[model samples]
Target: MELFFTSLLNGVTYGLLLFMLSSGLTLIFSMMGVLNFAHASFYMLGAYFGYVISSYVGFYPALLLAPLAVGAIGALIERYGMRRAHASGHLAELLFTFGLAFLIEEVVHLVWGKSPVPYRVPPSLDGPLFTLFSATFPTYKAFMMAVSVGMLAALYALLTRTRVGLLVQAALSKPDMVEALGHNVPRLFMLVFGGGVGLAALAGVIGGNAFVTEPGMAAAVGSIVFVVVVVGGLGSITGAFVASLAIGILQTFAVAVDYKLPFFDRVTVSQTAPVLPYLIMVLMLIARPRGLMGTRET
Candidate 1:
């Protein structure tokens, strides 16, 4: 029972982290109609950037400023690179992002080397915060949960309660209509794209230390983010959130269980836990071709 509760807490924290990454990708894809292959690369960049910034200024400042820096880079990419690719077509845009992902990886290697950096939770947040059911929860993990929920709340408020939010939703489906109303649709697109990537970067800053920080960190988690987006529904933030938490909990609980399949006695269930997300994704694809919350494509 203690083990079950402990795994539950871990799963929730992990799920919230996945939401941080998936939310940004969902927003970018929904608004721009682009599957950003490079989104995870931005996450890797955030970790590297946060590590550097934290070394000099401390984790608090890195947490505050790293996302802003990453967002600015995303905005520039939209303006100079993606915008040009958009003019050519979706294929061109996807190819551009694919190449950009590699470029970011190479840049990370050049700047930070291929080794995992020493990115640790801040000393202030390193200790256990509380105990439940004979299980101790780390202060850092709780902090992550709070930050994730706060970001989720802030995003919801921005979109549902503010003029900018309305304009953003309008821009997603009716860019031309918004443009006709004297709004700058292209600039809004840039801002949305940038903001989305920035959110990913923020996830990296928090998740890097929680997981591992290395040149391959993006590739390590990149596919899962896409899976979350697809299972939840492409271009659906709410869907992404649901998928993220579900996957996180599913994976965490799978790891905690020790059982063997009737047919596959050679492999422990924990050994196969890594494949659970892909399995869920396959089932989702079969059951709902349009995704849990996605609209039918014409």
Candidate 2:
């Protein structure tokens, strides 16, 4: 019972982290119809920016400034780089983002080198929040959960209750009509793209210290973000939320289990934890390509 309860908490924490990272990608895809391969790179940039900014001022300031910096960069990319690529077609845009990911990784190597930086959790949130059985949950993890939930709430309210959201949603399905109504559709795309990447950077600001701050961190989570997005359904924020928690809990419990499969005696459940999400993705594709709670077909 103790193990189950503890694992459940840890799993939810990890799942929420995944949601934070993937939500940005979901928003970008849903609003702009662009896959954004470089999305996780922005997340990596956020962590590094947070590290540098926090080193100079503090974590709280970095928490605010880092995402803003990343968001600006994203907007610029959309304006200068992606805007030009958009003229060619969706394939061009996809290729542009795919190459952009490599460029960002190389830039990281040039600036920060390959070594992991000292991006520790803030001293204020370094201790335990509460104990379950013999296990103690870290305050930082609780802070992460709070931030993730808060972000979800804020995003929900912004999209459903604001004029800006209505315009953005209008642009998504009827760009021409929105433009005919006198809104700058192109600028709207830039903002949506920027906002999406900004969300990714925000995740980095919080997650970098909780995990590690390294150039390779983007690659580590990039694939999983896609899996979550796809498993939850492409362009579905609610689906992403559900999938994030599900995958988070699934992987967390898998790590703690020791059972072996009937045929694969050599592999324990714990050993398969790394590939479980991908396996789920494959199974999901086979079973229901549209994804859980997803409105569009994959």
Candidate 3:
């Protein structure tokens, strides 16, 4: 019982973290039809930025400042680099971003070295939040869950209840029409890209200390994020949310179990946990290519 409950909690927490990262990618794709290959690089930047800012000021201020700094960088990238690539087509955009990922990684190596930085959780949230049947859940994990939920709520309200959201949605489906109405469609695209990466950075700010803060962190979670995005549906926020939690729980439980497969008796479930998300993605694509809550076919 204790293991089950602990795994469940851990799964949800991990899933929400995935959502925090995926939501930004979903927004950018849904709004601009641009799949950012360098999205995880921005996430890595967030953690490093948060670490530096927090060291100087504190976690609270770093929480706000790091994302803003990354967002501004994202805006500049979109304006100068991505904007030019957009004219050349999707392949150009993809190649640009793919190369940008390597560039960011090299920069991190140059700046922070190859070693993992000592990015610890805030002292205030350092201890266990509660105990369940001898299994203690960390306060930082609870804090992560709260932030993830809060972000979801805020994003929902922004898209559904605000004028800016309406414009964003309008621009998504009808960019020319929005531009005809005097809206700067190109500028909107820049903001959408910036905001998308900002969310990724926000995830990095929180997740870096929760997990590890290293230069390779982006590469580590980068593929899983795309799995979440694809499994949740290409451009569906709700689909992403559902997929994140499902994958989170599935992998968490798999790590806890030791059952062997029928034919592969040498491989335990725990040993296979690392491959679970990709396996699920493959199965999802085969069974329902549109994804759980996705509106369009992939």
Candidate 4:
């Protein structure tokens, strides 16, 4: 029972981290109708940039500046690169991002090399916050959870409360109508894209320390982030949040359980744990084609 509770807590924390990544992707997809293949590359950039900036200015400042720098780059890509591709078609946009992913990886290797950088948790959050049933919970994980929750709340408010949020929502449904009302739809698209990338970078800033910060980290996490978005629903932030938590807990608990089935008596459940998320995704597609919270309208 204690083990179950401990794994539950770990899973929730991991899920929240996944939410931090998936939320941004969902937002971009919702607004632009584009599945950003390079979103995780921006995340890797965040981790690498944060490591370098934090080494000089400290983690707190890196937390602020790294995302801003990445957001600017994303804005530039949208204005100059993605905008042109948009004219060519959605396929062009996707291929552009797909190529950009490799470009970012190559640049990462050029600048930081192919090894994991020393992106350790800051000393202030390096110790355990509390212990339960002989299981220690790290302060850093708690901090990560708090940040994810806070961002979730902030994003919810921005979309539901503010005038810009209202406009963005309106634009999502009727870009032409919103443009007719004298709003700059293109500029809004750029802002939303940049903001989404900023969110991804923020995730990278924290997640890099939580896991590993290597050139290949983006590729490692990119597919999972997409699965979370797909399972939760393409355009639903609420769905993404719920799905992230589910996957997080599912993966963590799966790793803790050891079982031997009749046909595969020699193979432990843990041995196949890595494929569990994919299995869940396949089931989701079969059962709920539009996703748990996704609308067929999307």
Candidate 5:
């Protein structure tokens, strides 16, 4: 029972991390109607950039600054590159992002080299938050959960309560209408895209130390990020939130087990282990195509 509670808590923590990544991806998709394939690259960049900042200053400042820098880069990409790519079509936008992802990874390798970098947990947060039933939960995980919740709340309030949030929401509903109203829709798009990338980067900064800060980390988490967004439903931040948490829980729980079927316990095999998420996603695509909490498409 204690172990179960521990895994459940761990699952929730992992889910928040997923939320941080998927929330940004969902927003970019909703605002731009173009999949930013390089979203995870920004995440990788955040980790690397945070490492640099951490070396110079401290983890606290690195946590705050790295994402802002990545946001700036994302804005540049949207303003110069994505705007041009948008003219060609959604396919072009996706291809552009894919190319951008490739380039970013290459740049990362160039700067950080091909080897994995060590991003250790901060000494301050390295210890356990508390021990329950002889199980110790790290303080950093609690800090991460707190940060994710804070970020999600900020995002929610911005989208629903603020004027810019309304504009972005309106923009999502009808970009042409928003533009016709004399709003700089393109700039709005760039801002949203930048904001989205920034959120992903923020997740990167925190998660890098918790997980591993490495070039390959992006590729490892990238597809799962997409799955979270897709499962959450396009154009729905609420859905994204729910999905991010759900995927995070699912992934964390999946790794916490060593199980066998009641009847098939004797016939154990590792081949069917890792593909559960894809299977579940496929089921979601088939059943709830728009995803839970998704609004009707315009």
Candidate 6:
């Protein structure tokens, strides 16, 4: 029972992290109609940036400033890099992003080297919050949960309660109409794109230490972020949220279980951990092409 509960909690936590990354990616895709292969690369950038800032300053300030830095980078990329690629169309945009992802990874290697950097939790959040069923749950995990929930709630409120949010949504729903109505959709796109990048960076900031801060970490987990976005449904915030949580739980539980077959006694056991989420993602796509909540085409 304890083990089950432990796995459940871990899953939820992982799901929140997934949400942080995928939510931004979905928003970017929906608004710009571009698939950003570099989204996860930015995530890796966030972790490294957060580590640098936190090392010199402190975690709290790093948490606030790192996302802004990432957002600025996103805006620059959009203004120059993506804008030039935009002339050629979606294929161009995707290729641009893919190339950008590789450049970013190489840059990370050049700047930080190929070694993993350890950024431990802040002193305040270093200790265990409590012991459950003889298992210790670290306070940092709770801090991560709080940050994820807070950010999600803040994003929800912004989208539902603010005029800027309303205008952004309007533009997304009817770009032609919004442009006809005299709103600067281009500028709005920049802001929204930057905002999405910021959110991804923020997730990276908090999650760096929880996972590992390394050069290729973004590429490693990048596919999973894509899967969450697919599972949640493209361009649907609510769908993305649900999918993120679901993926987190799925991965967590997958690692916890020991796979065995009665009739397959001769089959050798794999030494590594579980990996059922990828299989589930494949089946989900095959069975539900639209995903659990996705609606956008192409």
Worst lDDT run of 10 residues, candidate 6, spans 266-275
Indicate the TM-score of model 1: 0.96
In order, candidate lDDTs are: 0.89, 0.93, 0.92, 0.92, 0.84, 0.83
Question: Each candidate's TM vs. the true structure?
Answer: 0.96, 0.98, 0.98, 0.97, 0.93, 0.93
What tens digits encode model 1's per-residue C-alpha lDDT throughout 1-298? 8888888888998899888888888888887898999999999999888998999999999998999999999999999999999999999999999999999999999988899999999999999899897778899988888888887888788778999889998987888899999999999989989998999899999999988999999999889998999998887777888888998999999998789867997987777779999998899888886677876441
Listed per model in order, the count of residue pairs whose N, CA or C atoms clash below 3 Å is: 0, 0, 0, 0, 1, 1
For model 3, the stretches where C-alpha displacement exceeds 4 angstroms are none
- What TM-score does candidate 5 reach? 0.93
Instruction: List candidate 4 segments past 4 Å from native.
Output: none
The candidate scoring highest on TM-score is: 2
Top candidate on lDDT is 2
lDDT of 6 by residue, 35-105 (tens): 88999998899899999999999999999899999999998899878878988998999999999999999
The candidate 3 region of ten consecutive residues with least summed lDDT is 289-298
Considering only N, C-alpha and C atoms within 3 Å, which residue pairs clash in candidate 1? none
Error of 2 at 103 (Å): 0.5
**lDDT per residue, candidate 3, 1-298, as tens digits?**
8788889988999899999989999889878888888899999999999999999999999999999999999999999999999999988998999999999999999999999999999999999888888878899989988998888888888887999889999998898899999999899889989999999999999999988999999999899999999999998888888899999999999999988977996998899998999999999999999788887875
What TM-score does prediction 2 earn?
0.98
User: What is the Å distance of residue 46 in model 3 from its true position?
Assistant: 0.2
C-alpha lDDT of residue 30 in model 6: 70
- Residue ranges of candidate 6 with Cα displaced over 4 Å: 262-274
